[model samples]
Target: MSTIAAISTPAGVGGIAVIRLSGSEAKTIAERFVRPLSDHKATYTPFVADGDTVDETMVTYYQAPHSYTGDDTVEIACHGSLYIQQAILQHLIAAGARLAEAGEFTRRAFLNGRLNLSQAEAVADLINSTTEASNQLALSQLRGGYQQKLKEMRQELLDLTALLELELDFSQEDVEFADRNRLLSLSENIENEAMRLVESFRTGNAVKNGIRVAIVGKPNVGKSSLLNALLDDDRAIVSNIPGTTRDTIEDTVTIDGLLIRFIDTAGIRHTDNPIEQAGIDRSMKAAKEADVVVYVVDATDKENLNNPNVPKIQGTTILAINKCDLIDHINTSTPNHIYISAKTGTGLDELKHAIVAPFKEVGDGAMLSNLRHFEAMKCLLAAIRQVRQGLEQGTPSDLVAIDLRDAIHHIGTITGEVTTDEILGTIFSRFCVGK
Candidate 1:
């Protein structure tokens, strides 16, 4: 195969950037740009271009079938000058290496069977990870945790399929190779496993992305201030007057390894002002859609909290009594209340802990965070349900077998065992160029 080369590290100025080369001729291509740093090198010698040996650098080599793409691979770490990086890449291209396409390295890994489709996708996730939770999840997937689980489930289905097929082959002999009770149990087990993975996607997806947390309250209740405090920046404008914020301002914060997207919405109130009323409508909409609602109340305005006129709260609303520093004395009668001075960053840590508490019950380790995987699991569960119903109704083995096969197909979709070109294209296209 032809050698492929790309700038593996991110673009722009940095301490260093990596240029990666892989394929049958990767070593040969690298040899052109790198000059050995030592005569009898204990470690692999650093290389520099023959004509332009400005600075010595390190070089490591991996032979074919053992490298990232299952091809000979070489990574060059050099000073991150755009011109210098481009020069090295250009020299490699001139020396018979072609530029790799977006995600080509990972795509090659998949094509070479070194990694499955799911694992290859995890490569992108790892690179794009912006939060600790996402990074851990991606690492788990990259290490084959998710793939191994899927493989076990698929093997279970395949075993049952094989037994069913064998029984059909011996139909003329009237043999009962697959016991009825064992078959039902196997189906149940597979269904339960799939259901568990399907259920985890809810929390996993939220954690992989940011959990949407919306700040809701009447105007001038320091919702914007709380947002700025949580984000550690003035992401939203603050004002002493009410109805100052006319739209939702979103900012992401990474707390306790979880990404939380804080959306500070316009204050909720019944206002005759057309612009203010429109903002209030949007606030209500954001409140309904958010995963968690931070219901901010002015500490001085105790009557508003007890007022029946306040709009009905929804979701897991945490009442944040803002402006606590201003109040001479604060009471603790309100349910699920936290006192905070967003201006002074008081009780913010406690609020962050409370926000992440609900998700802690979700087990540590790998989870099915991909939406496609979630959908496939859901389909598998439906098919399994059909099979279960068939068993309960004493349906013929043939009918149950059909449902089982359908379930297998849905499971296969997650690992690309039953995927299409369009699906593959859609998935890999999301990757940045030169991955």
Candidate 2:
């Protein structure tokens, strides 16, 4: 492969900037300006281009087969001046190094067998992670936690395929190479796991994006107040006037490491006005789609509590009684009820706990966050189901082998054991330039 080079660090002026080079001629091209380098050693040298010293920088070299791309690599740490960074990059490129495409370094790493496809995508997630939960999720995936699971399932399919093929080879001899019932049990376990990985996309998506929680109820019931209180910002206008909020107002905040987006939607009430009716329609949709719906109600008035339009929520529903400070006593008859005064911040912490509780129920395991990986796992799960059905029905061995091989292929796609250039280009193109 031809040599590629790019600025690896973030754009703009910082304390320092990194420019990286990889491929067969990386080291040789870097040596044009710097002194002779020792492998894996950082040497401070003057960067010379056009017979003029551009800047003094630190150069580190990594020899082939042990580097990030399994190729000769060079890194230059220079002062973060835009002019100097560009000067050094141009010099390197002028010496036969091509500018790298976005995520080319990591793509080369994947292509060279240093990292798998899922892990390569995780590198992007790790870069863009905004919260601790997201960071940990990306780190866990980068460490090959998900890859290991796929590897084990692939091994199971390989074993099953081998057994079936052997039975096919001896069909004329009337030989039973393995117990069908035992294979079924093992395959069932794999099926359960594939189901698990597919289902994890919910938690993974919630973490990658913020968990959705809609503050919904009749108008003027402190829905906006609750939204502001949750975000600790005056994100929504709080008013005593009914229908003051004509549309949904959304904001995100982190509570105990989990990111929750609280949407203050227009009150759920019938209105003859087309504008207010449109808002109500959107409010209903938000409540239905959110992972958790905060059913805000007034503590002083019980009349607006009964509503026929509250969407049927499939997820957690918290009946939050606002204006609790005004009421002398609290009532907690509902299953997931919380008494809170968004006025004085009373019970806000408890509300936060209740909000993050449902997200924690996804359990501790590698989750499917990337959409590509999710699609691949869905295929894998379907293939596993097909193989299980074939084995249970005593389908011909060769037919079972076809399903088994398909299962194997899906797993391979997840880990880059079987892939094409188009998929690789799409996956790596999402990354920032230089990584």
Q: Highest TM-score: which candidate?
A: 2
lDDT of 1 by residue, 42-136 (tens): 22434456665633445667777877888888877777888778878888888899999888888888888898888777887888788887888
Q: Relative to the unseen true structure, what is the C-alpha lDDT of residue 316 in candidate 2, on a scale of 0 to 100?
A: 78
How do the residues 1-435 of candidate 2 rate in per-residue lDDT, one tens digit apiece? 999999999988988999999999998899999988999999999988878999999999999988998899999999999998899999999999999999999988988999888888889899999988888888888888678867876886687678878999998998877678767876788789889888888778888788999999888889998888888888888788999888999888888787888889998777899999999999988988898888888887755444323457877788888898997866544455688999999989898998898666433346777788889889988988988999989888788788888888988998778899978978888899988
Please report how far candidate 2 places residue 315 from its true position, in Å.
2.7
* Over 4 Å off, model 1: 32-57, 169-175, 307-315, 325-334, 343-345, 360-364, 416-419
Residues forming the 10-long window of minimal summed lDDT in candidate 2: 302-311
Which ten-residue region of model 1 has the weakest summed lDDT? Answer: 36-45
TM-score of 1: 0.86
Deviating ranges (above 4 Å) for candidate 2: 169-173, 303-310, 360-365
Instruction: Report how far off residue 398 is in candidate 1 (Å).
Output: 3.0
lDDT (Cα, 0-100) at 334 in candidate 2: 46
Position 82, candidate 1: lDDT? 87
Against the hidden reference, what TM-scores do the models get?
Answer: 0.86, 0.95
